[model samples]
Target chain A: MKIAVLGSGNGGCAVAADFALKGHDVYLFDFEEFNENINAIMKNGGIFVDGDFVGFAEIKYAGHDIEKVITGADLIMVVRPAFGTKLFAEAAKGYIQKGQKIVICPGSCGGSLIFKKGLGLELEDESIIVSETSTLPYACRVIAAGKVHIYIKLLGGIYLAAIPSRLTENVLIDLKEVYPGIVPAKNVLQTTLQNGNPVIHPAVTLLNAALVEREKGDFYFYEEGVTPSVGRLMEAVDKERIEIGKKLEIEIIPNPVLGLIQGYMQESNYDTGYSKGRGFKGIKAQSKLDNRYMNEDVGYGLVFMSELGKQIEVETPIMDSIINIASVIMGKEYREMKSRTPETLGLSSYTVDELINVL
Target chain B: MKIAVLGSGNGGCAVAADFALKGHDVYLFDFEEFNENINAIMKNGGIFVDGDFVGFAEIKYAGHDIEKVITGADLIMVVRPAFGTKLFAEAAKGYIQKGQKIVICPGSCGGSLIFKKGLGLELEDESIIVSETSTLPYACRVIAAGKVHIYIKLLGGIYLAAIPSRLTENVLIDLKEVYPGIVPAKNVLQTTLQNGNPVIHPAVTLLNAALVEREKGDFYFYEEGVTPSVGRLMEAVDKERIEIGKKLEIEIIPNPVLGLIQGYMQESNYDTGYSKGRGFKGIKAQSKLDNRYMNEDVGYGLVFMSELGKQIEVETPIMDSIINIASVIMGKEYREMKSRTPETLGLSSYTVDELINVL
Candidate 1:
């Protein structure tokens, strides 16, 4: 099998290296501006994996050329921050071959729809299958250039859904050899709504905006930042997300329950679940408010959910409030930015029945 | 002139002691449940003053009897947290003399209206003048039982308005001897909308909820809590407040500018103005989220502003957001609580014109 990973960041390198070590032909690519990691991979001729998956994995090619990376690959993984989804989609416009599969690792609130629209493909088009997973399968990061560390390879609880729901199983079948625990979701909405970064990150970040700016996030994020009030906020946001899913006729797992299933939590509640979770034991908050927690999670994730709620007539007061507060803190109009919304995802005109039909 | 100061809390003790020092006959009263300070004042025969105003001021009366304090008082000052306004109003219901002048010191968003309604008096009742001040005249606290410490006497920027607009000047004339800088406002709406606590306290407290809970507020609140992002949230809420004022044809001063005029700030910008303000130099945050910052500020201040905005068709999204976020943090629905809303104040059915006319 052949795999092309479309980012050189932590998640991208982890996916590419883990699969390459399993004897798959892998190619790594990032934009020319992010050539540091790509250059390091080229110099090392491979990526070194540690922790959960150990050993060196050889890469067949490493470069900045999107065409060279996407030409004839059987599987293409778009693994990066939510903000980069459209940019990568645009870069892969004319190079995508028919019958190829593209998966947005951890669709941060409608990544598949944004990527599909960015590639100038209609939602119903089936020439190529574009799917998204509810979350990335590994707790990992790039320890150094050309070196990736995997903290925990998720044993289960990853949901994948392709555009035009009928083709979801076919795409899952292609990657089942590496990710046997992945399961099919109801549709792309399930994958998009089930991702919990937007539910947790923005609330914690907004409530702690002052501390992050003052102390540069000196405290342990999960242990100290997720206090009772912070946890209540996350529960409010998660409830809204689940409500939106129910309105769409999908059963979206609660974040804490999902956390328990994914091996990230020792408790089954929002407050102590993440604070005492072994999977997030030592993770510190971002050093600043301009990090992806606000930019991508609130900008792309909450904005999209709020807009969808508006379309479906579900009152998402908490979600809308978080977005408004975050926008003021960041000095950016996230709603107007339209980073990801029903309108941006080409679902603005679709009714509930039509949306269910399409997704 | 005779003056009765209700509430033995920080503001009440300061008001009572300052007036007694000015050769006025001042009586201090509090509920029997809060008799520690009252008993101490009775034992000492007065309140010992320090800081901005230094003296031993004799109190003619100190007890929990509402009639004993309100019997023949020329001026009645309700000085307490917003939550206590109605409770005190209930206590003074039958005891308020016909010719007495009642003022809610620092009307925390429609305190006058709430007091007026609680006293079972019509808005147009002219036998008694019911008014409210935009802010208390001093930044002081109770350092010990029967001892009050004054920080600043507020030489300017205190606004006073009566329920019946024509009586505002009469109340001002009575208060002129002690509060020489007090000015007549357009109405109680101006006074209610102009109080800066709702705009500043909840924003700071909500953003620092985790810190307040974890450290029990061991840091300088304004210096460390009012970072750029926290200041931005306050500015956003302030903008909504000023807009509500504008919709009612009142010119609400921006909080930073008001802070400058009230001698609380050394600068005129939101970010550094309060953080580096001379008046707020060493004031620490409340020791818990359940303090008056959340209860009085959000429950009364922002909720009132938001409900008024809804009545007048002015958008207060930021104010609503802060109220919603604060409600989640405190585990109470502030909006539904209706601590001080247009409806709770008896203005729910009034049109904007009718509201302006009655106020």
Candidate 2:
């Protein structure tokens, strides 16, 4: 399989290395501003993976040229945060090949929609298969310049769905070879709603905003930051997400159960699961509240969900609240800025059934 | 002057004692559930004032009888939080005399409106004068039963406004004798808009939520919790508040300036002022995120401002965000459960000018 991974952040590096080690021709590309990781990998001639997936993977191509990375690529993974979604899509506009599969790893709320819009492609365009996963498959981080630490390779329950609702199966069939845990979701709506990033990250990060700013990532975020009361807030937000799913007639996994499946928790309850769970044992809080945990999850993910809730007539007070708090903390208007919604996806005029059919 | 002080919380105790020492016939009342302070005062036959105001102040009356407190009282002050605005109004309804002046010290965002609704009185009702102050004058706390440690008495900049635009002068004249810092505002809109509590408390408390929950109020709130980034958020919310005031043609002192006026902060900028302010020194953060900072301030204060902004077609994104975040953390629909707005105040149908007139 020929794969092009966009962005060389922690997730991007992990994906590129894992694929390259599996003997797939992997091309990793990042913008000039984000070329540090890829430049390090290029200099090192390979990426060293530790923890669950331990190996050195030699990437076939590593550069800033979007055309060089996308040309003739069988699968293109948009692995950047929501902040970079549009930029990557814009870069991939003229270069995206026909019949190529595009996957937004950990879509970070409406990634597919944002990408589709950015690509200037119609929502119903079927020339290229576009899919998004609920979250990234590997709970990994960059330990060094060129070395990535793969914490937990999710054994099961990584959800994948395609825009226009038809291309999910084919995309899943190919990607499942690398991520056996990946499963086909009903639609992009399912994949979007199933995203627990917006549910957990922003709330947890904002709840511990001052501490994160104070400690500079000194403590385990999940273990120390998420107390009983904070746990209750996470549950309330999770309930709102589930309620939105019910309204949309989409089957979504609850947060705790999903956390267990995603290898983020041992318990199927918020407090015990997040605080004591081995899956999140070594995960440190973001050094600042302005990181992707907020910018991506709250700014894009929660904003998208809130917009979706407005479209579906389901009140997402908790999601709105998180987006609101994140926007203030980040000094940006998230809802007014980039957000994935029915309107943005060109499904604003569609009824719930019609919208479901289209997605 | 015969004054009846309602609610036995920190502010209420301070008000009761201050007025009593100033030779006013002060009647302090609390519900049975909150009668502990008054009971202690009754037992002590006075309130022990320590800090800025130092001495024992004899109370003419101290009990749970609302009638005993309201009867023959020239002035009635509701110093409870916004949470008790309605209950206090209900308690003071029939007992309130025709010529008596009622003041909600530090109205906590639309307290005058909420009080009017609870009292079932028209905004135009001039037989009795109703007024609200931008904030409580003294930043004090009760060290023990019937004992309060006064921090700083505000020298100036406590805004006072009446329900109708007409009654502000008389209310200000009387309140000035007790709270010399009290100055006449344009209307209740000025008083409500001038409130910096909703701006500072909810953001700071929510930002430092996990730390507060974990440490149980061990650290000084402003000095430790209001980091540079968190201070930026406070400034952003303050901007939205200032915008609301502009839209309504009401003059609002910026949060930092208001803080200086209310004696909570000395510096004019958020970071330098809050982190280093003598007024905010030694103030402890709430032990939990569910306290009045989130509950009263975000739930009522921000909600009211957002609603007003919506009515006037002014955007209050930051205020809306704070309210939303606070609501989720507190596990309640603050906008629905408790909020002071045009509709809640029965002024929903009024135009901007009419609303201004009524307020």
Candidate 3:
């Protein structure tokens, strides 16, 4: 199997290394401005992996050229934050060949829809398969140049869904080799609703905003930041997500069970689970309020979810609140921009059933 | 001159003591459950003042009996949180006599309007004059029963407005004796729009949620909690407020200037004022998120402001966001209850101009 990773950030590096270690030819690509990691990988001729996944894995290609990276690749994975999807989509649209699969790892929120729109591809187009997962498979980071640390490789929580819905199985066949635990979703909407990042990141970051600003990333994000009151806010957001999922007829896992499966906590409810959860004990808070937690998760993820609620006529007051707060803190007009919305995706005219069938 | 001060908490005690010190016959009143302070004052034959104003000022009457408290009072002051306005109104309804003036100290947001609704009285009634001030005259707290520590007595900040705009001057003349700095506003809407507590408390409390939970009221709230990011959120809410005021043709002071006038901060902008302000240095953060900051400010103050924006067809995203977050944290459905809204005040049927004229 040949794979191309269209980002050189921590998620991109981890995904590329895992595939290479599994005996697949992996090509890592990034824009020149973010080419430092790929440049180090090129210099070392491989990626250094530590923690859960150990040893070095050789990559066949590492560069800024998108065409060279994806040449003859069987699968291409976009592993950047949701905000970076449009850029990758623009970069890949001209180079992508027929039958090549593009899977967005942790679409964060509505990644596949936004990416497909960026490519100007129709849902019925069968030349290429586009799919998205609920979240990234590994909680990993780049420790240093050419070196990555794998905290926990997700086991049973990740879900994948393809554009046009029917193509989900085709994308899953090849992806299963790299991510054996990955399962097919009913549709992209199902995958998006299962995205717990939108439920967790923004609320936790916002509720702990002062601490984050004061300590400058010195506090344990989950252990010290998420108090009982903070956890309830996240739960309220999760309830809205669950209601939206129900309205769409998707069998969405409630956030606590999903959190447990995704390695966030030992318990199955918000109050006890978030406060006592050891899975997220030592993670440092973001030093700034404008990080990916608010930018991607709230701006992209919650904005899309809240808009979907609007389309389905399901009230999402909590989700809307998170987006509004994120906009103020980040100094962005998210509501006015109608960001990642059904209207932006050109799906505003479709009924919920139509949207599901189209996906 | 006899003055009736309802709801004997810290503010009530302080205001009652201030009037008594000025040689007015003060009748301090509260429910029996909260009579501890008044009972101690009665035992001491007056209130024990400390800090700026020191001495025991005699009170003619101090009890939970509403009828006895207002029997011969020249003025009535409601000094409780905005949430308590209804209880006070209900208690004083039949007991209230024509020509007897009632004023809400720190009306917070729409205090006069909500109180009017609770009394089932129209602005045109003219039987009684109802007015409100932007904030309390002094920043004081009860060190113990009958003992209040006065921090600062506002010099030239408070603004008062009556329900019927024409009645403002008459209400202010008597109020000016006790509150020497009191100035007549254009209307109650102007006073409500000038409210700075609603603009400050909820946003700062929410942004510093974790710190408040962990520190448990140990931190100096304004100096430590109002980071640049948190200040920006309040500014965003303030922008919505200013825009709403403009739509209604009210001369609303921006929150920073209003904060300086009300003595919350020294500077006139959020970034510099909140960080460098000497006025807010020693105020402690609430020990829990369920305090009056969220309950009163967000529930009554921001809720009314946002609903006013809705009625005027102006956008109040930040205000709405704060209310939504507060609802989730406090486990209440604020929007559904239409908490302290224009409709609740029976002004929903009126046009913006009509509502303005009625005020």
Candidate 4:
């Protein structure tokens, strides 16, 4: 399969490397400034995949030229966070070949909707098929200029939904070739609500605002920072998220259960049949300040969850509190700074049924 | 008027010294450890008042004897914070005579309710009248031992409402004779909601959590801490407060108007008002590790407000957020540590009408 990987961040580098190692023709395209990174990749001549991208022999290409990357590509994966998803998607719309499937690994909840809205693309824009998974497949980061170090390969069947439902099957086929573990969610809303970042990250981060800001970010955020009380708050927020999901009829695996799948929760804590680690075999974690977890997850993902609650007549005090607190931390109101809200997403006045229909 | 000012903390010393100057037989009582503070009375034998307690005299009656202070007292003003209001009320209950009145200076929205419950008394505990004002009249604290410095005296009618309707007139007469400024609120609920501490303190403290924790007992609390965003949260909380009051058919004052009364907002920038030292008159800044703003106001006050919102079905996201944030900072689950939640206060499952009846 011919694949074009967009964005040269952690997710992009990791995804491009993985696909290339899997004997797929992978052309990873980013900007000129990242040419140092791309040139290093070319010098290395192949990706070093510790888990998913283990073998370096089976490879294709890496570059700053989108024209070369997207030309006759069978699939295009938008691996950037929610902030850059729409821009890359619209850019792809201008250049990509007709019938190229666009897969967003770790769609961060609202990416699919973003593409459809940002580009003014119709649901029946048959040439482009947009699908999203709940999260990227690995707890990985770039080890050096060109080398991506894959850490925990996350597990769990990712949610896959295509625009207009008509092209879903084709997109699913393309993603299945890459990720055989892909689990099909009913629709994009299910995929969006399945987001763990908004439900957990912002609640903990905003609540622990003082701790983080006190000594200038020296804490092991998850291992130590996510204490019992913080976990309870996450549960409170998770309650709201699950409630909204239930209201929308989105099947929500419990947090601990999902965590077991995502490798955050210890499955040994419970007798559930779920395994210990979420095998994120294909992606990396972006540890930058402007990273998705803090910015997009808090801003976009939380906005969607909170707004969905508003639409469904569910009171998400925990979610709203976290959103507001995050906004204050970021020095912007979630309603205004958040790229997607019920208001920004044109769903502020939407009824539950209307929201479901629109999504 | 013979006045027994309970609790020889800042308020206690100030009240004792102020009443003594007014020629009332004022007896100040506290634990024996506060004898060091008696030096303020020893140095000058009374408070050196600049504004309200202007004239200093050595009329010495400050002691740790509760029984001696209560002897022959006409009015015993219970000036303790809400957390200890119950214990003080119960303690005062055993010491009072038939015609004596127990006035909780800022009935703090529901002080009478709490007082009546704590003493195992009924709504018609007519013998001992319990009334409250919106707040303490003086913006004064015992900065040094026994030295109760006065700031701006709040220029509003202090609210008052007796527990039993029968004792309302008698209580008013007693309180007015001493205070000469008691504006009778409609009920205990009215007086309780009149509390501006919950509306102001927690919002500022929690929003400034990062700064407070980072600065670590070095920053100006009320005078320099309340930012515009903090003020917005205050307004949001106040809106919920007013909504709760409306649902319960009680009048709660607006926050901005209250701020205007506090002399913080007078069409001036924060830096200007704060730098020029014109913000928050009567309210001295807290530079202690333990802030009453975070501990009492956020813990006791916001939990009370949150509980009230639950009773009235009004959503107070900001209030709950600040409370939870404060709890995180203090390492306590505020909702649990809070003795004033709707559930704890016996209003947990009350209907609107039922809550109204209780109020």
- On a 0 to 100 scale, what is the lDDT of residue A248 in model 2? 81
Please write out the lDDT profile of model 4 over residues B1-359, one tens digit for every residue. Answer: 77887776666666676677777777766656657776556566666656554766444467666777787888887776776678776666566676677777766546667876776777656666666666787667666765667765555556777775445667777655446655766666677777777877766555444445435546566555654445555667777778888988877767556545555455433223332333364353455425777777777777888877876778877777777556655667778876677665556788888766654
lDDT per residue (tens digit) for residues B155-215 in model 1: 7799999988789998999888889889999999999988999998999988888889888
- Where is model 2 chain A poorest over a 10-residue stretch in terms of lDDT? A338-347
lDDT ranking of the models: 1, 3, 2, 4
TM-score of each: 0.96, 0.84, 0.90, 0.67
Relative to the true structure, candidate 4 reaches a TM of 0.67
Task: Rank by DockQ, highest first.
Answer: 1, 3, 2, 4
> What is the interface root-mean-square deviation of candidate 2?
1.7
What tens-digit string does per-residue lDDT give for candidate 1 at A314-346? 899999999999999899999999988888788
Model 2, residue A12: what's the lDDT? 95
Residue A264 lDDT in candidate 3: 64
Q: Per-residue lDDT for A352 in model 1?
A: 90
Better model by TM-score: candidate 2 vs candidate 4: 2
Q: In terms of lDDT, which candidate is strongest?
A: 1
lDDT: worst 10-residue window of model 3 chain B: B274-283
List model 2 lDDT by residue over A1-359, tens digit each: 88999989989999999889889999999999887788888888879899887989998778898898999999999897877888899899999878999999977777888898888888778999888998888889999888999888887889998887777898988887899889888888888889888888887888888888888988888988888767877887888888889888887898899878778788999787888887787889887766878877776677877887887899987777677767766778888885656676666787788866767
Writing each residue's lDDT as its tens digit, candidate 4 over A7-118 gives 7777787888877766788888776766765777777876665644465533366776677888898888878778787777666656765667777776776677676666
Point to the candidate with the largest TM-score.
Answer: 1
